[model samples]
Target chain A: MRNMAKGSFKVQVLQAREGAIVASVNRLLAEKGYDAMTVDEVAADVGIAKASLYKHFTSKEELAAAAMIRLLDHALAFLATLEAQPKATALERLKAVARWTLQVQLAGEMPALPAQNSTLRAALAANKTYLDRLMLVSDKLGEWITAGQKASQLNRKLPPELILYTLFARACDPVLSLLKAGGKYSDEQIVDLLLTTCFDGLCGHAKLRLA
Target chain B: MRNMAKGSFKVQVLQAREGAIVASVNRLLAEKGYDAMTVDEVAADVGIAKASLYKHFTSKEELAAAAMIRLLDHALAFLATLEAQPKATALERLKAVARWTLQVQLAGEMPALPAQNSTLRAALAANKTYLDRLMLVSDKLGEWITAGQKASQLNRKLPPELILYTLFARACDPVLSLLKAGGKYSDEQIVDLLLTTCFDGLCGHAKLRLA
Candidate 1:
C-alpha cells in the first residue's frame, strides 16, 4: 500500500510539472509568437532545465501544439457552458464565442501562430489532441452559424466557413491591439466596437457596391 | 561628356538592382511573414551574395522598411488617381482604396508586417520617407471616412480611426487567403465575397447584442 501511495504521488507531481510547463509555453507563445519563441525561453520560464523541457516536449512545434491544445480545451469548456444555457439563440451563442475569444486575447492568453508555416502546420496536423479539439470548436461554431442563417440572424448568402474564418481572424486582430495601444478605450469598449464591426460592419445599413 | 554619360548609366543600373531587391523582399514578406523570413533566403532569392545585399540595405529591418516605402509610394500614387476621379463619391473612393488593397494582396505584392515587432516598428518610425508616405495615405483615408460618416454612408457612431483601422486590417485579412486555399471560388469570386463581408458584414442588417 505504501509503494502504491508513493507511485501515485510521483504521478501527481509529474502532472503538475507538466501543467506548469504548458502554462509557461502558452504565455511565451502569446508574447513572442511561435517563430520568435525559443525552447530555451520556455524552459527558463518553467523554472526547469532545457533538457527537462525536452523530456516533456521534443521540439518548439510540440510546445506550440501543447499550448494550442490547452487553449482549445478551454474553448470547448466555454462552449459547453454556453450550450447548457437553454433558450439562447444560436446567434447569441456565436457572439458569446466571439466575445470569449476577445476576452482571452485581451488577457494575453491567445497564441498567435502564423497561418503559413508549413512545419508548424505539419506539427499541428499530426497532433491528434490539437486537431480533435479544434474540430470540436469548429463544428460547434458551424452549427450555430447555420442556425443563425436559417433564422435570418446571419447573412444567408455568406459561406459558413467564411464566417468562421472571420471570427477566427478576430481572435488575433491587430485592431484590438491598436486600440489597446492607443490607450483610447477600455477593454470592454474595444470589445464592443470590434464586435460591432465584426457583425454590423462599418457600413451600417448602407447599401454596399463594388468599387 | 563621356564620363557623365557613363555615370548616368551606372546610377540607372544601381537603381534597377535596388528595385529588384525590394520586390524580392516584398514577395518573401508576403509568403513567409516577417518572423519566419531570413536574410539568407532573401539574398538567395535576389541572386546576390549577402555582402552585396548589405551594400544596399543594412539590416533585415531596413530591407522590410524599404519594401514598405515602395508599397506606400504605390499607395500614394493610387490615392492620387482616385482623387483625380471626377465624380466618385467619398464612399466610392474609399471602396476603391479597399478594392485596390485587396487586389495588391491577391497579386502577392503586399508585405505583411507584424504589428508588434518593436525593432521593425522603430525602423519604420524612424524612416521619414515611409512615415510621410504612410501619413499621406492615412490622412487621405481619414478624410474619406469622415466624409462617409458625415454623409451617413458609413456607421456614424463608429470612430473614423476605427474605420481607417478596419480598412487597413482588411488588407491583411486571412480570410482572403483562406478562401483562396479552399479552391471553391475564383479570385474574382473570392474578392467579391470578401468585399461583401468587409462592407455588409455577416449580419446583413441584423442587430447585434452582447452575449
Candidate 2:
C-alpha cells in the first residue's frame, strides 16, 4: 500500500513538472518568439536544469512542437466549449473563436511566434499529432464557413480557404496589440472595432448600398 | 581622349556592379529570407569575390539596408508616376497603387520580407533616406484617405491609419499569392476578387442582406 501511494505521488509530481515546463515554454514563445527562444532558457525559466528539459523533450524542435500541440489542444477545447453552448450560429461560433484568439493574444498567453523558421515549420508539418489537431480545427471552421455561406451569412462567392487564412491572419494582427498598447481605445472598444472591420466590411452604408 | 573615355567606362562598370549586388541580395532575401541569407552566396551570385562584396558593403546588414532603400525608392518612384496622371480619383489612384504592388509581387520583384531581424528593423527605423520616402508616401495616402472619407467613399468611423495599413497589408498579403499558386483561381480572377474584397465588404449585397 505504501509503495503504491509513493508511486502515485511520483506520477503526479512528474505530471506537475511537465505542465510547468510547457507553461514556461508557452510564455517564452509568446514573449520572445520561437527563433529567439532557446531550450536552456525554457529550462532555466522552469527552474530545471538543461538536461532535465531534454528529458521532457529531446530537442528544441520537439519542445517547440510540444508547445504548439498544446496550443492546438487549447483551441480544440475552446471549440468544444462553444459547441456545448446551446443554439450557436455558425457566425457566432466564428466570432467566438476570433474573440478567444484576441483574448489569448492580449493576455500574452499566445505563442505569437513567426512562421519564418523553416525548421520549426518542418517540425510542425511532420508532427502527426499537431497536424491532426490543426486539420480537425480547420475542418470545424470550414464547416462554419460553408454553413454561413449556405445560410447567406457569408459571401457565397468568397472561397472558404480565404476565410480561414483571414482568421489565421488575426492571430498576428499587429493592429490588435498595437491599438491596445497605444491606450487610445479601451480593450473592448478595440475588440469591437476589429470585429466590425473584419466582418461587416470597412465601407460605410453608402458603399454598402451600392453593393 | 582615350584615357578619359576609359575612366567614364570604368565608372559605368562600377555602377553596374553595385546594381548587380543589390539585385542578388534582393533575390536571396526573398528566397531564404534575411536570417538565412549569407554574404558568400550573395557574392557568388553577384559574380564577385567576398572581398569585393565587402568593399561595396562592409557588412551583411548594410547590404540588406541598401536593398530595402532601393525598394523604397522604387515605391516612391511609382507614386511619382501616379501623381503625374491627372483626373484620377483618390480610390482610383489607390487601386492603381494596389495593382502595381500586386504586379510587382507577381513578377517576383516586390520585397515582402518578413520582420524577423531586430537589427534590420533598428537600421530601417534610423534610416533617414528610407524613412523620408516612407513618410512621404504615407502622408500622401493619409490625405487620400481623409478625402475618400469626406467624399463618402470610405468608412468615416474607421481611422485613416487602418485604411493605410489595409492597403500596406496587400504588399504582404499571403492570401493573394497562396490562392493563386494553389491553382484554384487564375491570377486575373484572384486579383479581381482580392480587389473587391479590399474596397467593398465581403457580403455581396452588404448590410446583412442575406436573402
**Chain A TM-scores, one per candidate?**
0.93, 0.90
Q: Give the TM-score of candidate 1.
A: 0.93
Off by over 4 Å in 2: A1-7, A177-183, A204-211, B1-8, B204-211
lDDT tens digits, residue span B111-172, model 2 = 64545456777777777877887888899888888987888777777767777777776776
A1-211, model 2: which lDDT tens digit per residue? Answer: 5647457777889988998898989998888777677887898899989998888787888777778888889999999998898799988888889888888877888885555567877878898998998899999899988998888876787778877877766776767755765688767767666666666554634322223
Each candidate's number of clashing pairs is 0, 0
TM-score of 2: 0.87
DockQ list for all candidates: 0.48, 0.38
**How displaced is residue B134 in candidate 2, in Å?**
0.9
For candidate 1 chain B, which ten residues in a row score worst on lDDT? B202-211
Task: Judging by TM-score against the true structure, name the best candidate.
Answer: 1
What ranges in model 1 sit over 4 Å off? A1-7, A205-211, B1-7, B205-211
What tens-digit string does per-residue lDDT give for candidate 1 at B1-211?
5647557777889989999999999999998888888999999998999999999998999999999989989989999999998799998998888888999999987898887677888998998988898899999999999999899888888878889998998788998998888998777777777777777778875322211
